[model samples]
Target chain A: AQSVTQLDSQVPVFEEAPVELRCNYSSSVSVYLFWYVQYPNQGLQLLLKYLSGSTLVESINGFEAEFNKSQTSFHLRKPSVHISDTAEYFCAVTRGGADGLTFGKGTHLIIQP
Target chain B: NAGVTQTPKFRILKIGQSMTLQCTQDMNHNYMYWYRQDPGMGLKLIYYSVGAGITDKGEVPNGYNVSRSTTEDFPLRLELAAPSQTSVYFCASSYLESTGELFFGEGSRLTVL
Candidate 1:
């Protein structure tokens, strides 16, 4: 079984400041990686994903993650964050042929103005 | 189109009570999933369906049951609720075109008293 671990439980940053959320995974085979964000009282929104191809995947909202196969990690980073970017983030992974992703404990991103 | 939908946005139940979380998708997706989100914990898969008739247990499915009778409906049943089961639940669907991008519903908040 594949598992994901998010090192940080909470992250607080000033608006417009850069931020990075660390994620590591445990899997012996090929896998897919994903990052998802959940705003307060809302469902999850996909931030980015790395399935195949270039290891660095970008999202529309200025978020990006680099899949480091050597380290078995996919960390989400943003050069600058907004107040609206404050939310809970989750890192997930799935094996090559599996249909579901295994998720890590979330990291709460709090943007302070 | 309504991507994914879950009903009873909020519910409170006594221990040992029973309830069913309703879910539906209108995007004609072949894959549907049920997930539970605990505070500070990322979403955990409870159940999943490959199509209308094939349902399977996920990472955390011991206390839950699910059925997929139609392409659009997948209901999660909690036969005997517990405080440990209190969490926000989400329903999601995705196309096979991608293994990591899923469309999620707003979510259902369940509390066990």
Candidate 2:
């Protein structure tokens, strides 16, 4: 079985400030990691993913997550965040097979200007 | 594209009542999943279907049942409602199980009293 843990329950940052949301996972087999973002009243959307290859995967919206195998972490980071980036972020992991992902409790990003 | 569609955006049910949440995807995805989101919990996988006629349990599948009789439809059934069952349900589909992005529905909010 796979499990995900998000260390922060809520993070408040000023607009245009950098932020990092920590995520760690535990799995017996190889895993695929993903970051999903959910806006106020919308469903979750994929922000980025790490399957294989470069440990650093980036989303088009300037969000990036680095997969650290030794640390079992896939922390999401953004150099500069906007007010619109306020949302709930989730970290998920799967064993790279026909299985559903295990998700973290989520980190609520609150941007203040 | 309509993408993944989930019916009854909001529903209220009393304890011991039974109801079915309908889900459908028009993207011809072979993998479909049902997840529930609580207040602080990100999301928990309740059930998943690899394809038509093939369904499996996910991380949290105790109080829910699911059926996938066709390639486009996967309905989640709650035999008897409980207060714990009150949550936002999301239906998602993907072309690949672990390596692809998951397209999600708007979500179905269910309240049980």
Candidate 3:
């Protein structure tokens, strides 16, 4: 079985400040990691994913995440956050060939302006 | 293109009432899924379909039913709504399996009293 965990329930950061939302996963087999963003009253949008090759992946809006094998972590980071970035972020994982995903509770990224 | 579309942006129901949440995707994705998001929690899978005429339960599917009659339409049915079923419902589709990078619809917010 695979499980994901997001340590922080909420992360408040000032505008233009860097922030990090930590995610960890436990699985017996190979896995793929993903970070999704949900704006207010909206569906989820794919922020970034870690399939293979690069341990570090980035999104278009300056969001990035690094996958650590030894620590079983895939923490998301943003160099400069904006007020618009205030949203709920989710960390999810799936096995290489599984038909479903296991999601973390989520991290509410509150960008203080 | 409308990646995914869910009907009835909002709905209110009483105990034991029944309703259907409509979902459609223009991407011709073979895989479709339904998920529910409660307050302060990540999404939990409700139902999934690999293709037309095939459906299966997800993490949480006690109060929900679904059918995949065609590639574009995957509707979720609530047999007997309960207060616990009050939440935001999401429809998602993916071109392939083994990845969590699915395209999601806006969502359907349901409030049961």
**Lowest lDDT block of 10, candidate 3 chain A:** A94-103
DockQ of all candidate complexes: 0.72, 0.74, 0.69
Q: Where's the lowest-lDDT run of ten residues in candidate 2 chain A?
A: A94-103
Chain A TM-scores of each predicted structure, in the order given, are 0.96, 0.98, 0.97
Give candidate 1 misplaced runs (Cα > 4 Å).
Answer: A96-98
lDDT of 2: 0.93
**How would the candidate models be sorted by TM-score, starting from the highest?**
2, 3, 1
Candidate number with greatest lDDT: 2
Q: State how far residue A6 of model 1 sits from its true place (Å).
A: 0.5
If scored against the real structure, what TM-score would every candidate get?
Answer: 0.96, 0.97, 0.96
Docking class of 3: medium
> Where is model 2 chain B poorest over a 10-residue stretch in terms of lDDT?
B94-103
Fraction of true A-B contacts recovered by candidate 2 = 0.68
The interface root-mean-square deviation of each model, in the order shown, is: 1.5, 1.3, 1.5
- Error (Å) of candidate 1 at residue B69 is 0.8
Model 3 score (lDDT):
0.91
Comparing 1 and 2 on DockQ, the stronger one? 2
User: What CAPRI grade goes to candidate 1?
Assistant: medium
| Predicted candidate 1 versus true structure: per-residue lDDT over B15-108, tens digit per residue | 9999999999999988899999887778889999988889988889988999999999999999999999999999998886668788899999
Q: List where candidate 3 sits over 4 angstroms from the true fold.
A: none
* Candidate 3, A41-65: lDDT as tens digits: 8899899999999899999889999
lDDT of 2 by residue, B27-110 (tens): 999999999999888888899999999999987899899999999999999989999999999999988644647889999999
